[model samples]
Each structure stands twice: as C-alpha cells, then as structure tokens.
Target: MEMQPATDSRLELWHELMQFYIREAWLLDERRFREWLDLFTDDVFYFMPRRLNIHRSEPERELSPVGDLAIFEDDKTYLTMRVERLETGMAWGEDPPSRTRHLVGNLVAEPQPGGEVKAKTAFILYRSHHETEENVFAGYRDDVLRPTAGEWKIARRTIVLDSNVILAKNLSVFF
Candidate 1:
C-alpha cells in the first residue's frame, strides 16, 4: 500500500477506522466474546509482552517480547478457545462474570505496505467483580489491520501496558 496523500477522504477513512475500534470496545464491554472474536482475522497474532522497569542505562532491555515472558501470546486458535471457555460458563475466573468498561481513544492510522493499516490507540479498561474493588488497566495497542470483505479485521495486535506490576488478581478480561 503506497502512501496516499492526506485529504478529506483520508480523514473520513480514519474516522471509519475509529468506529471499528469503538465497536470492538463495545463488544468486549458487553461480554460479547464471540462478536469480538469476529473482528479479528483468522491469522491474528494478539500479544501483550511484559513491561519491565529497568535502569535507564539499560533502556534496550526494558521491554522484551522475544524469548521472554508475556501476559498473552495468543493466536486465533487460542483466542477461539478462550471464547469457547467463556461460553461454557465454567471458567472459574470469570464464572460470575465481571462488569467491564473499555475506553479507547487517541487513535492514529497509517497505511502499511500490503494494503493493511497500522493503527495505534490508547486504552483503559475498568472491571468490577462481585465483591472486589474495581481494577483499572491502562495500555496502548499497536495493531495491523487488513481489509477483508469490505471490512477491516485485526491481523496483529501488540499491547503495551502502562503498569509494571499488575494489581489485579486475574486477567480474565481482554484489554
């Protein structure tokens, strides 16, 4: 995908892409896992690498996604299994279900090399379980979206969380 000149039409396209993110957030917040899964491509690579706060002198080793730990490194198959588990209503972590709100903003979209879009967005997820205090997670996501059947589908996602240490007990909800 060659770089197109910025124009009013490009702005409109960006707005449409933003709408996709909004819809995705809604689906997740509503616990419509199946619908949310539909937004992803069959070859989606969703990852959330570990965020480490190290010495500034070794900035190169701060964040590692390769040969290191990660919160999530899921392919489409794993994502499907997660959704199926949720549907079974037997996932101990989410059996009671958590009330969640997903807020997405600061979206920026750029055309990639193969008719794909590289989009970045800021996200904040709030979750309230039965009798537990609300848990808040803040992060930013870098996504590669492919146009499929006249709609955009997430092909890849790399989420970088803001916190170095997660305070939540279980990360059952999608960020």
Candidate 2:
C-alpha cells in the first residue's frame, strides 16, 4: 500500500520522538551512561543479534535465532552492571576511553496500541581510541517507547547492525 502523508499532530509527535533520540545520542556520546540508562524503563530489553553473511535463499539464517549468541542481550539490571563496571576505572578495555560520535537520522514513528510508540531510526556510530583505533558501526534500531510521568522511556530496543563481522576489539561503547 502507498504511504500517506503525516497529519499535523503526527508530524509534531514525530519531531518530538526524533528529538528524544537525538538527546539519547548526546548522552551516550558524553559518556553519561547513567543518564542514558534512565531513558529506558525498568523492564527494558536491549538486544543486538549477530548477522549471518548467508545467501538470500537462506532467509531463516539471516539473524541469530532466539537461543543463539548475540552481541548484547541485556535487561535493565545487566545494563546497570555494565555502567557500574565502566565507572570503576577498572575496565581495561576502556582505560584510554573511546571518543564517540553518534549520528541518528531517518526516524519513523507510529503509535502502537497500549499507549506505546514504535519507532525506527538509522544510526552511524564512530568510535576512536588510543592512537589509531577507529571503528564505524552502521545500523537501524527498532524501539518501543512508552510514556511515563510525562517522559518517554524505552520499553524495548533492537539494534540491527549491518555488518556480519565486527572489527572492534570490544563493544565497550553504548550505541
């Protein structure tokens, strides 16, 4: 079916959602992991499954299945642990700290039932550390956002990275 133009209210909601995502990116880029974690609901599920470089005919094997290994499959508690680990100054992987820039764009949001909004956004994350380490991760995210206390919170998020093989030594940076 052909897509119809957004209504005025829809446009306004879209703009607000886009701004929310931009704010999220800023928080991560600023290394404010606690603040960024606050954006998610207590029951949030953040997942990033590994992709398979398979032929188009093997549709069932494209993304890692439910029981397969994923780069990130964290609940709120696990996410908190990650943030805490980074704060201890003992995470050797982040000893030098990675400077990152998160570029978020091409957002499309639609209201879902039960007072939630499902939004998809494209992102390009650039991370540089040490003297010459640099890695670029490009992907789009599917997020389910719920409003609580007049603010939006991520109830679920699935990050679909484009590449099959990640070159980064460790995914220490939050996307």
Candidate 3:
C-alpha cells in the first residue's frame, strides 16, 4: 500500500515521536525497565511475533499471524510481571544475566487517519552473554503510535524479525 503524505504539522509531530522512540531505546539498552514502562500508556500493547520458515510459495499470513506466534503480547499488567520476575531473580534467563545492545534506525513515520501515526523502523539487536558470547536479532518494528496526555504512547507494536531461525536459548530481552 502507498503511504499517505504527511502534512507539515503531522511531520513535526512525527519527528518528535521518533525522538521519543530513540529515548525509549536508550532506556531499554541501559536496562531501565521502570523508565521504559513510563513511556507506555495504561493500555499499551507491546509484542514480538516469532519469525518462522515456510516454503517460498507460502503466503506470510498462513505462516505467521500476529496473534498466533507471538513471543510476547503484553499489556501493563503482564509487563509488570516480567519486570518483577527479572528483579526478584526468578527469571532464570536473567540469572546468568545476558547483556544486550539495541541499534535502531531507518525510521519511517507516516500519518494515518484518526490522529494516529504509523511508523516502521529497522533494528539490529546485539545480545551478548558470559556464557554464549554473542548473537544478533535484526528486524523491523511496525508501530501504531498515538499522542495521549502530552506524550506519545505505543498503541500497538509488531516486530518482524529478519531471520527465520532463532539461535538464542530464549528471548529475554525486549527488542
């Protein structure tokens, strides 16, 4: 589908929104979960769908639907649980403690109907550990952002991973 041209006002708003996302990325890379949570709205939907391998002729929808293969589909409550688990040492994945760095760029923000903006950004996530050394997960995040209470909050996020196969023991990092 063709993108709708952004108006001058909308373009300005989109620029601010992109900066907001960059800050959020910084917080996450710094392991600032509480601060990261602050950026989300009460009804935010943060999610990552599992990328899978299928025949080249197969339609993407038949292979991986947004609702079906999600590594995460979280609201504020669930996000809180995840954070709590990480904090209390119950999350085994973090027991060994993997360090991660997320590099996000190639942001494209376009205005949508109903005071919403649709944005897509390319990301290359580098994750390292004392045990396994290093691995990378590269993808594009498709987001639906809306301005609320003087801040931009993600209403929805869909992560499309570049690789069909995953090598990490588990996805503990928020990409």
Model 1 lDDT per residue over 1-175, tens place: 3455779978897899999999999999888899899999999999998889999898887778655778899999999998899888689888889899999998888876889989999999999998966899998999999999999999999998998988898888997
Q: Write down the TM-score for model 1.
A: 0.93
After superposition, candidate 1 runs with Cα above 4 Å error? 1-6
Give the alpha carbon lDDT tens digit for every residue of 1-175 in model 2.
1234889988899899989999999999999999999999999999998899999999888889657898899999999999999889999898778999999998888787898998999999999999998999999998999999999999999998998878778889887
Model 2, stretches more than 4 Å misplaced?
Answer: 1-4
What does each candidate score in C-alpha RMSD?
Answer: 2.5, 1.5, 2.3
- The top-ranked prediction according to lDDT is 2
Q: For model 1, what is the C-alpha lDDT against the true structure?
A: 0.89
Q: Report the CA-based lDDT of candidate 2 relative to the real structure.
A: 0.91
Model 3: lowest-lDDT 10 consecutive positions:
58-67
Off by over 4 Å in 3: 1-11
**Cα RMSD, model 1:** 2.5
**Model 1: which residue pairs collide?**
1-113
TM-score of each: 0.93, 0.95, 0.85
